[model samples]
Target: MAMAVPAQTIAGYDRFPWDAILLQTNSALMNNTDPNVWASQIISTLRSTAVTLPSVDLAHRLVSHLFWNHHSPIAWKLLDIAASLNLLPPLLLVALLSTRIVPMRKVYPQAYRLYLELVKQYVLMLQFRNNSPNYEMIMESIDNVLQLSQVYSHKVCEPGVALVEFVFSILWQLLEAILDDEGLLDHVPENKPRWLSRSHDMDIAEHDCINEMKTEQKEGMQRKNTMIAIEIIVQLLQNKMTSRLLCLVHRNMPSYWGSFNHQMQLIASKSSILKNLKHITADTLLSLMENIHGVVSCNTKSKLESNVVIPAGSQIAFGGQCEGSSWSSIWLPIDLILEDALDGGHVAALSAIEIITGMNV
Candidate 1:
C-alpha cells in the first residue's frame, strides 16, 4: 500500500501549484492575444481546484487585478466566462461597476461594447433568482453602477444607451420588488398602541425600536434607489437621448408603471426627489419636447397607433401648507409627450392633439 501523505504536507504541496497557476494567469492576462482562450484556461483551473478555497475569492482577485491594470480585453473575456458559468461574484460586479468608461474608452475603442455586455449580465443576474452570497452587496454594486452612469452621462456613447436602458429596467423591477414586499400602498396606521403593563410595555418598546430601525434602513435604501433613478432620467434627457428613453419607458409602462409610479409618489412625498425634479432646466425639457414631437410625427407618418398616453388624474399633492398640486408626477414623461404634441404646429401632431383635446373636453 502507498503511504498516506501528511495533511499539512499535502496542503503545502497544493498551495505551491495554486500560487504558480495564479502567477501564470496574471502574467498571461497582460499579453494574451486570445482573451477567451486565456479566460477559459483560468476558469477551468479555478473550477478544477480541489482545495477548500472559495471560487468567488479567486474570481474576485482576478477581476480586481484586471480592472486595476485596465486590461479591458482580458477583463471582458473574464466577464464572458463568468456569465457562462452563472457566477456573478459581488467583488467582480463591484469591480466592473467601479471601472470608469472614460479611461477604458481611451485604452480600448470597443470599451462601450464591453460595458454593454457587463450591463446585460447584471440584468440577467438580477432577473434570475440566483443564490448570490450577499444580496446587499449586489445591491450596493448596482447603486455604484447607477452613480457611475450619472457621473459619466456626458461621456455616454451609442452603446451606453443600451446600458442605460438595461439599468433603468433593472431599477424599475427592483423598486417593484421592494414595494411588493413592504406593501407600501396600504394606509399608514394612525394611532399608537396602549401598554397592559410596565414590563410588557418595555418588551413592546424594544420590539418597536428594532422594527423601526429595520424600516428606516429599508426606507433609506429605497430613497437612494429612487434618487438614482431620477438622476438617470435627468441625465438621459440632458444627453438628448429622450426618444430612446421614452421608448423604453413606453415598453415597460403597462406591466410595471402603476406600481412604479405609486412608489415614486411615496418617494417624492417624503424625500428630495421632487426638489431635484424642480431643478431640471427648461432647455432639457424643451429638448425632451422636441424628441417627443419627432416620435409622434414618425408614428403618424407610419400610421401606427401610439400607445403612449399621459393618464388623467395623475396629479401629485405635496404635504403641509402646499396649496396647489404639482405636475411632478411619476408619469411626467407621458405629460411631456402630450404637451409636445399639442403645442407642436404640424399636420402630424393634429391627430394626437385632437385626441387629448377631446379627452379633456
Candidate 2:
C-alpha cells in the first residue's frame, strides 16, 4: 500500500503561485523599459497560468495611469494582455468606458484605435467563456457607454460620432454572442391546430395543453437567458440616448446600418421574445425621419426663399419654364420638399442632404 499523504501537503500541492506570479508581473510592467517586451512577457505569464488573479488589480491601476498620462498605446498593449487573460476587472472596464475617452478619440486617433482593439479583445474573451463571471461587469460597462453617449449628445463635435458607433458595435457583438450561445436562434415550432369536436370544452382543453407546454419550455435555462438578452436589447432601444445614438449610426454608416438591420430582422423573425423589435425599429426610424425634417426645416426655411435664384447658364428649370430671366420662382415648402424627397423615391437625396447639413438624420 502507498503511504497516505498529509492533508496540508495535499492542499499545498493544489495551491498555485498566485501571489508570486502577480508580483513578478506587476514589477515587470512597472519597471520594464521596453513596453513591447514587457507586453510579451505578461502575455506569456498569463497564458501559462490560465487564470485571472485578483491581484491583476495592480496591472489595472498601472494601465489606468498610462492611459491618463498619454501613453495609451502602451496602456492598450497592457490591456490586451489582461483581456487575453480574461482579467479585466469590473472597475477598470467601467473606467475605460467613461466619458473622459470621448475627446481622446479625436485628439489621439492612434491611441483611440488601440483602445478599440483592447475593447474588442475583451469582448472576444467574454464571448469565448460560457459562464462569464463578468456578466455584471459587462452590463455596467454598457450603462457607462450609454452615459458617455448622453454626455456626448450635448457637445457639438465629431468625436462623439465615433464613440457612439463603437458603443453600438460592442453592445451588438456582446449581446449577439450571448443570444447565440443560449440557443435563441433555434426555431420555436408553432402550436398545431387541434381537431375541434362539436363541443367547446374540447377546444378549451386543447388550448390549455398548448399553453402548458409553452410555459414549460419558457421556464428552461436557455429560454430564460434568451429572454434576458431580448429584454436588455429592448431596454436599450427604449433609452433615449442609446436610441439616438443608433439612429445617428443608421443615418451615417450605411454598411454598419445594413448589417445591424439584417441582424435585427433575424432576431425579430426567429425569436418570439423579439417579435416587437420590428415594430420598435419602425418607430425609431420614423422618429429619426421626423427629427431630420424638423432640423432641416428650421435651418433651411430662411435660406429657401432667398437662395431660390437659379444660377446663370443652368439647364435646370422649375414648373416648365426654360431659361427665363428671374421668372417669379415658386418656393417649395419644407414639408413638401421632405415628402418629395422621402416619399417620392428620393431617399438617397435626403440622406445626402442630411449628411451635408450635419443634422444627423
Roughly what TM-score does model 2 have, to 2 decimal places?
0.30
Q: Kindly provide the TM-score of model 1 when superposed on the true structure, using C-alpha atoms.
A: 0.33
Query: How much is the lDDT of residue 347 in candidate 2?
Result: 15
lDDT of 1 at 57: 45
Candidate 2: residue 29 lDDT (0-100) = 47
Worst 10 residues of 2 by lDDT: 193-202
Off by over 4 Å in 1: 1-21, 30-40, 47-56, 68-72, 90-98, 102-109, 121-126, 132-361
Residue-wise lDDT of candidate 2 within 1-361, one digit each (tens)? 0011222222343443344444454565466435346555544444445443322343444444454442423344445444434455523453443333322332333333343334433322222111244333333343344443343232322222333444465556434543354355333121310111122211212222224344444245334444444544554454433444454445444454555555555565555544444444434433443453123333334545676643322111112221213322443322222222232221121221112222110
lDDT at 218 for candidate 1?
A: 44
Summarize candidate 1's per-residue lDDT along 206-253 as a digit string, tens digits.
Answer: 112224345655455445444443444444333323443444443333
lDDT of 2 at 53: 38
